[model samples]
Target: MPDHVLITGGGSGIGLAIARALAAQGHPVTITGRRAEVLEAAAAETPGLFPQVMDVTEPESVEAGVAAARAARGPILIHVANAGIAEGRSLRKTTPEFWRSIMATNLDGAYLSIRACLPDMQAEGRGRVIAVASIAGLRGLKGAPAYSASKHGMIGLIRSLSEDHLGSAITFNALCPGYVDTDIVTRNVESISARAGIDADAAMEIMVSANRHGRLIHADEVAAAALWLASDAASSVNGQAIEIAGGQV
Candidate 1:
């Protein structure tokens, strides 16, 4: 059997796009998310896509889910730590709960997911770990100190892991995208509109303008980069953050 690819948050958005891209290439894929129905529906729509309900924030849940995936589809050769939450709040208004929640999902979740998959990858002598970090990870955003910090921590984790595993068959990389046109962006627009007391269109424009191309990115664009990173061509591309924001940082 082909090596199985596991994608967290594969029920929707960029994760779903990556799942579809890899599945079409004949890779067995296990997609995990918190919502069973959404995952099931996505699996129904995409052949070779298997659904596993998992909460990445919980260590036990991650351990069990990884084991179940390995049992059902063999050892995972590609682990995409793509599950995360993005929200913009000024440091002054960012509560401990808010900061912790973002950190738990964006930082802790990736750590747990990657840790769970590393053993199998190590045994197999080859694997790919693609983390869905954000451009905010590379640089700070105006009103999202907590979100930015969490993403930075994720990149730090990926970089540190790559260093620790240097010369190993496994490769670790991060995709930093700016304002992708996903459900997350839609929700962020609504939130920004309410918070900034502006119309939705204006709020959306704020995000659109953040990208160097002056537009929201497509999910497939990021997926394409992920496909490349998973390919043999990217075996040496470790500890690097590829920017998909359509221009220089």
Candidate 2:
């Protein structure tokens, strides 16, 4: 098990679950998010979680966040780039600003995070990077063109890093989950309802039905996969998109 892990967007949802999972294993976890209050609150709930407020989209903020993590808890052995936004807007309806903003937070944010953390990990000669992509990344989502693009780009970034760091102690991989039960899913449900004139529950059902298993995924399930990736058991796993989509190809 890693001694120190840095997780972005760890204030809530899958990231927070990952923080708890790693902390339970006795790994000192540093969780970064844009909201200080949420991060502090989550840290209060989860033992050994150090909170660092950072906007991942900003390179300066990411650099500072990583430095803070290193200062507080040695070199970060595991890095989870889990910060992202899921907005389902059609190509025709999505503006340039919206698309760029999504890419900035999802794709570019992961890149910046990895870039900021590499030097310290390289010095340590070992590192793990787990990017939280989505099943939409594997295939296009009907109404989420921009969101799909950003996730696809995240997978691409992870794959490239894996290739670049081959033979080194560093590994990069991605997790692609469909309809995980989180606040993001709840927000998406509201979006679906408002846009399609359906009830929120029906919108949720639509998402659940998209999964082959016809159910929502728990955040801890995704966190478990991340835990595996961070562990020695998955040393050989790199540059792969581990899917938790029930049955999406």
Candidate 3:
């Protein structure tokens, strides 16, 4: 049997989708989030999914949570550092607190997650590290400098980790997805609608247009990408940021 997989923020949206996909493939999947109720509900419905309440932004919480998961399942061979916040503000309005919050959740959380899971990966001599980054990691996203910088740091972390363990069986990659249809998008639409004084549909349309295909990418599409990266076929695909945005013609 394959070693267990651990995914952060796995109670909903992209992370949950990825966890479900992996579980469907017969891998024991531990889905983690700060919300105990949400994770418990998801675990109850999913056959192979095990819920672990974890706040990625807290280092001690991560270490303890990861140990609990390890005790329940086997060593975590695949670590998906997917927990993150997607808040944005203009540079002029971005406060130090706001910046730190973003970094703590997006970048530092990823680092902690990786550090916690990497030992098992190192012991096993085979592993996969997947970080769910955003298109903003590839290019500047207007009005979201903090979010973009955090994602960029995530990708950089993956790249550096891959190099640090070069010649090992473990592979690290980042998924840079375009705007996907998720709860985050829904929340953003609401915020944008308020900020721009536009209707919800128009605000959502602005995000849809941001994708090259002129439509929001489905959560499953990103999940499929994660599934592939976790598979043996992607063993050679390390130190790269795979883009899920529809390519230009």
| Best model number under TM-score | 1
Clashes of each: 0, 0, 0
- What is the per-residue lDDT of model 1 for residues 8-126, given as tens digits with 9 covering 90 to 100? 99999999999999999999999999999999999999999999999999999999999999999899999999999989899999999999999999999999999999999999899
Q: Better model by lDDT, 2 or 3?
A: 3
Predictions in order: lDDT: 0.95, 0.91, 0.93
Over 69-148, each residue of candidate 3 has an lDDT whose tens digit, in order, gives 99998899999999999877899889999999999999999999999999999999999999999899989699999999
Total clashes in model 3, counting residue pairs 3 or more apart in sequence or in different chains: 0
Alpha-carbon RMSD to native, per candidate: 0.7, 1.0, 1.1
How would you order the candidates by TM-score, starting with the best?
A: 1, 3, 2
Better of 1 and 3 by TM-score: 1
Clashing pairs in 2: none
> Ten consecutive residues with minimal summed lDDT in candidate 1?
1-10
- In model 3, residue pairs whose N, Cα or C atoms come closer than 3 Å (at least 3 residues apart or on different chains), thus clashing, are none
Model 2 has an lDDT value of: 0.91
Regions more than 4 Å wrong, model 3: none
Can you give the TM-score per candidate against the true fold?
0.99, 0.98, 0.98
Clash pairs detected, candidate 1 = none
> Model 2 — TM-score against the truth?
0.98
